[model samples]
Target: MVNVIIRSNEANAAATALTLAARDHHVCLLSDKVSPGLYQFSYFGEPRNEVLRAVDELKAGAPVIGVVFAEGEDVQAGMQDVLRVASPQLMVIVGGGITGAVEAAEAARRFGLDTSSVLQIGAFLFGGNLSSVRAEKHDVLAGFLGPETPDHLVELALATFPRLSLGNPAAVALSSINALFHVPPMLLNAMSVERAESIRFYVEGFGDSVCRLLLELDADRLRLGAALGLGLVPVQELKARYSGPDAPKGLSLREQVNTLSSQTAALPSSFHHRFLRHELRSSFAPMAALAAAVRVDVPTISSILRLSEILLEEDILDHAARPAQDFLNLMNTHSLSIN
Candidate 1:
């Protein structure tokens, strides 16, 4: 049986769900510890050097197949390093932060191992009164399948910027492209000041991290624009789900709403682009990337979320919401099913 480890602040809930699911598969608890062996590890909260050490220990005992970060970033580099150098079958899933995932993906690609998967489950909108308490948050996870994250992610970067290079352009483009994974839902949340502020700090951190990464690469103006152009990838996915399959419909989940709020603030022009339909075309790829992080709430995400409301002039909270896709690709879907 394949060993499975699940970790999260919401551990009880995840454990409950996994217990039911594990009846059909071998599920091993990583939180308390039972044995030294190969396992599928999952957890949330801040990343720590100790966690990396524990992971190294596990690898020392047996091969690790996949890892799920519930909510953290501390040991990201260490985790990525190990995934690159030691285990090729490792997979990682994180919440909705772009910086860590980007670095991980780049590291994995550089290592030449191409079978990793990342999943951005939901948005991290902090303020608005949301409908369902459970819906307000999500569990971010990762699974490793090889020396590096799947080559498909790199392909996605390329597809998002057919005209850009794999070097500087990829760095900026990937940053923009990954940014959207965190915005749309947060806009709809509009919960409260404390919550918004909390999420804002995270957003700022992620944005700064991406910007810093680009600066390190010496990314130029055009590269940034190309990255911005990549931002639309996640927005379009949001549009397809809530806005409408074809006509850019109104928001759809009023029934599921637990709370509601209204805001009348005007944002800077640069920030306003997330809501504009035309701008969506420009942000094509970055949006998907932002969603693929360690945590899901942030400010750039709020800007995008706010834009949707501004452009549509409609309350997204008062509509029928559909189920969002669970995985980005079928391979990811299947990987989730593996014992």
Candidate 2:
């Protein structure tokens, strides 16, 4: 069994730790907020017991799975903490936004860590919250931020996640399904967010208008990807791929999204919610920056970014521009072959 160190918080992190523990891996769950000790948590309503330990409790060289969902400074802080503690043989970044992963890789460099050992999953592998989790049967994209190589780290990652497949990190980042799926619904339902109404995020929120906007944004995303010489799977295709065998056949984007019965359907109470703030700042803003660099016009995406900035009363696009440029520079320096 792998001696795993899981840096966790929020539903995805908790659920990931629980899933690993259930699989008989020696999972040492580390959290800044959760108190250190043995804890019993449920997985899909079944009682499962696992220990939630502190980072310092980690062995000198265990593999760490960083289930960081936070963006910006939080991503840097969390990743630095993990590197400081275990100096892990392999560090897997799961569920963080595209820019969050870039921030994490930079943090590793600051610590003199071998960035080639860092692997990032394009999305979270599960579909539920901390109270319970249901494993997603879809394949996930993962790749090193640094130069590609065959190593024990890759083997360990593959063993841990059987559905994982290696791909170009740039493609993986640009292929972020969250930017396509989460942003439009949140933008269209601004009044609901302002009112703090508790509507189902997908089932009730993904109306015809939202789907139309999502399609337009997704088309621009594809264009951006093509400009960068990357083949991006359309958002509808991605949803179908992730939804696995139960996905309805030949459904439109709206029909497919609205029919996702297993989705955790709670709308964010305010604009500050990660669905809005994080997606715009960490996901779409960076995409917009990259699109601009390549002289691609992503009008729908541009519109959403402007609307989000107006709603949030901040300039997210400008904030993301420098970092996005830096990310492209890093990819070039490492010979990651973006084009």
Candidate number of the best TM-score: 2
How do the residues 192-290 of candidate 2 rate in per-residue lDDT, one tens digit apiece? 989988799997888899989988988998998888777888887777777788788887778878778554578888887878888787778888898
Model 2 per-residue lDDT at 79: 68
Residue 248 of candidate 2: its Cα lDDT?
A: 85
Per-residue lDDT of candidate 1, residues 1-339 (tens digit): 222333322333233223322233233333332332332332222121111123333323432333344233322444454444344243443332333344444444565645344332222212111111121121111223222445665454233212222222122222332234223322333343214343331232224343333232222222333433322223233323322223324433221111112112322233233323222322322332333322333334334434665645654322211101211222232332211
Off by over 4 Å in 1: 6-20, 32-64, 73-88, 106-231, 234-339
RMSD of each: 16.1, 2.5
lDDT, each prediction: 0.31, 0.74
Residue 100 in candidate 1 has what lDDT? 34
For model 2, name the residue pairs that clash. none
- Prediction 2 TM-score vs. true: 0.90
